[model samples]
Target: MYEWSETDLMIREAVRGFIDKEIRPNLDALESGEMPPYPIIRTLFAEFGIDTMAADGVEKMLATQRARESGTDSGGAGSGSGSGGGLEGQDSLMAVVISELSGACMGLVSALGVSIGLGATTIMSRGTLAQKERWLPGIVTMEKVAAWAITEPDSGSDAFGGMRTYVRRDGDDYILNGRKTFITNGPHADVLIVYAKLDEGAAAGADGADAVPARRDRKVLTFVLEKGMDGLTQSAPFKKMGLHSSPTGELFFDDVRLGRDRLLGETEEHRGGDGRESAKSSFTAERIGVATMALGIIEECHRLCVDYSRERTLWGQEIGRFQLIQLKLAKMEVARMNVRNMVFNSIERARAGKPLSLAEASAMKLYSSEAATDVAMDAVQLFGGNGYMAEYRVEQLARDAKSLMIYAGSNEIQVTHIAKGLLGR
Candidate 1:
């Protein structure tokens, strides 16, 4: 029963038009690693006025916060509709953009989400007004690319417990040392959000002096670093199975020095558990938004499958007559329906002042991601030999869809989170 308003429909059309005009023609170059995604993304921002939209949205949020501080709202806590009205619409518009672009290139949306959703969001939420003013404008406008680095060589699933990076206080600055791998946008990110454990300067340190403080009791701290900082080395992009448009790489910080201002929030309060909580909350948003990407993948795969089934004749009859081909088409339709409903439901709930809990977000991610992977594979199967070839698009989609289950915490981890939340409740 969920449906887009007329305004939402127009937005979808605009996004699709841009993707067709600027993206599909260049898919070969993008996929072959001959071109980077940032330039295309910047062009999209300009052509669609996404920069202006983002700026207006930011100002609206600030105005609402000011009113809250001044007690100018006669209606009270939930009185001003600005927060609910503007925010919900933004979320919907975001979903539309993600879904449409995903249909064309998953890598584009993946890169976009990390910079704006993860990078800008972290500073905006945890940083002070000064920090936000200094860093946010460039990122929000796509003028500068950003990367969020939390996953280390040792920390993939158990991000907190498995983290090996550590930051220690050194006179008026902090010394950071660690190696982080599989960082999105790392190779060329103008801004980097790095997470490491705070060192208490205890006797036990690295280099066999003691053991690098194996306490495992330290707090996780987040710091913002620029690309050319001293002792900070960024590796070249890694060859990946898919998402060629997105350049993934490694980061190395060898005694990189940082000041208090670099620490998010410019305070020590971020340690202990506040920083961890903030990252987890960001994960929930990221996970919930996965539904939109999955929905797009499902719709695209189903569309291709349905069309193929009708035109692809076998044994002197259309494959659509074959029950086997028909089954795949049916299942794809079901997945498309289920995912679309979840997406619209989330939008409606947000508009009504209801935000999903962590467990709910995990559930959506789990189901939607699996569905996307399934649908993409089925589309490949429906195409038989053609589906497996790069010319068919579904081949790329299959690889891209697989990443959904792995990133943002694997689907396996999501199950445990959902269970823990249920048991706690």
Candidate 2:
């Protein structure tokens, strides 16, 4: 049984209060493909300092301690050890805050997820002191928004295997060339964490360049690609089945030149070498971020369905009274609890400075994403005709839920990851 501290409770209440006051009323406006007023997001950040809470002075103390032991600083807040203590308590708080904020609106939550988890994580975990000094402050302060560019036109699940994007070293610059598809926040991101092959031959030689590698190989490298860089172009937003407000689009990099500093990790010593170790590390963090986002969306779907069932009625009784409806609700509850527990447990392990096996992360992502899809579909069924119509929120839930299965390493890809992790190469 996971216990919540007073601080955790307070954070949850505060975030939920802000959501109730600021976001819920504006749901209609946001749902119509209109951006949620920036002032609202700004107000929450200003009043609560949401972005920095997980990185602030006290939080930093804890994170540093945890990072020292874990050899990686991946958990957001309270994962660190400090004089203040209560690391586990802090993890619960962070989760509650994320869940509440996400429950209000997934677009906002996803934006934060990418910006904080991926955007800041790249610099925090891999950047040099200078790079951290330059990027971390902005990300921590919410001054810059970050997006990840890994999924290419034909490289959804097979991203690393078929990654055609190439970065060629040219003295002090690396020229990047490629196209990324289905990029979340592509239209508005200020920074991009891109993965590309620095040397295709090295990658292939290391056995990390194929979807079904012959060995336990690693070679792909990642970079912190910034916006407005030369050769970085964004396309008009693509029409999507869901998350219309999230603004998915394409990123084109043609002869994009970046300073050597943009290269994330050890480059000189590992030149012409497989970046398998680095790639595995990065993927581990990314999988956690993806799982958290999926969990948030699924929780929301469950909440909405439960709310609808209780309120809507037929034949003088709540529709929830029906046996079939009750069964659907029951299954949703069980799935929701299962996925939530998995996510929270994973976060705890991460906070405790424990190594999370790739199989565990992949399994969690696969289960939660599929759970979200199933719950959303059931929600649509519960809403009957209303669920199919955009007028009702269930349809939107269903739409956004599908993307969960497709993105962040599709469920199919996750299955492969799990199998690989379990099969010993």
Candidate 3:
């Protein structure tokens, strides 16, 4: 229902064309365990500005201007200074780009999402000016791939409570010790945005008590750790049910010493003074990024399912001819529309400088991810046996769709968040 600009339309068409020519034909190879040729993927993203679209440009001209005005950049490793309109416009444009790219390949979309949404945005939101200066260029230029390290072996839905990682401050340096699991792009990441607890004392209490203790508040902080940081190690890519093209792995940080500058936002000692306000601003933008990715996947699943239903036949008629099929397709269409609108509206709200309640962001992720999974499963059903086969794209979509609900935040957690919000908690 959202109106698209002339440039938006043009970009969409161009991205579609590129995917058709370069990515669609290679889906089989990619799904069968071979990574898509990086050159082609890289070229498409570069030409379309998929990776650095948030920044607008490399000279930092627009970003600097926005920073001067809004006190932050366009959702990158800094603040923006521009009017709300500029930020909203960028979000809309980026959403279009994400949907188009994801329509062809979710794995590629995930890569781009991690790099721009999680990687670059972390720095923009929490990185010091020096850290931003050191890291933003390579990210925007696609020279360095980035990954987010938040989930761990025991922490998925309960990320904050389940974190076992600890950081010990020692003079001008901090020693990081922990392990991260199921990290996207972990094996390929040149830079990692890791979250660890600063207060080891808070974790010394009883088991379940420490899990979600109040004192652990100071433990919730982020750090920008890099590859080859001493005691940091990455395991080989783990085979996955879907998104095989994306390299997923575990990360181990054992007493990795980092300079003071590596800490994100403020340290625990200074956190109570200013860190809360800063984290609020940063997380608002980061949630928007995650919501955008979810919207993209949902839109792609809906569009593809609809298209497939219209083409495939059963009992001498197109499957889409059946009333039940029509109903499924209609439901998907409605869900897609709702999610798209929610995403855009959230971005607009964010641009207007409103922080999203945990419920709002979780709602977007929950609804869109569920929609994507439902549509993907229906797409496979509509395709019959062909959908189950790897030869067709539907099977791949179904596989890729599985993770959306689990990542970002589980649907169950999203439900809990919504409940908490309703209870006014």
The better candidate by lDDT, 2 or 3, is: 3
Looking at model 2, report the run of 10 residues with the lowest lDDT sum: 80-89
Task: List the global CA lDDT of all models.
Answer: 0.84, 0.69, 0.70
Which has the higher lDDT value, candidate number 1 or candidate number 2?
Answer: 1
Clashing pairs in 2: 62-80, 62-81, 63-80, 218-276, 219-275, 219-276
- Candidate 1 lDDT, tens digit per residue, 99-133? 99998998988899899888888887777556766
TM-score for predicted model 3 compared with the true structure: 0.84
Best by TM-score: 1
Q: Name the lDDT of candidate 3.
A: 0.70
Error of 1 at 338 (Å): 0.9
Question: For candidate 2, what is the lDDT?
Answer: 0.69
**Candidate 3: residue 179 Cα off by (Å):** 0.3
TM-score ranking, high to low: 1, 3, 2
lDDT of 2 by residue, 6-51 (tens): 8877887788888888887887777665754334555777877654
- Over all chains combined, what TM-score does candidate 1 have? 0.92
User: On a 0 to 1 TM-score scale, where does candidate 2 land against the true structure?
Assistant: 0.83
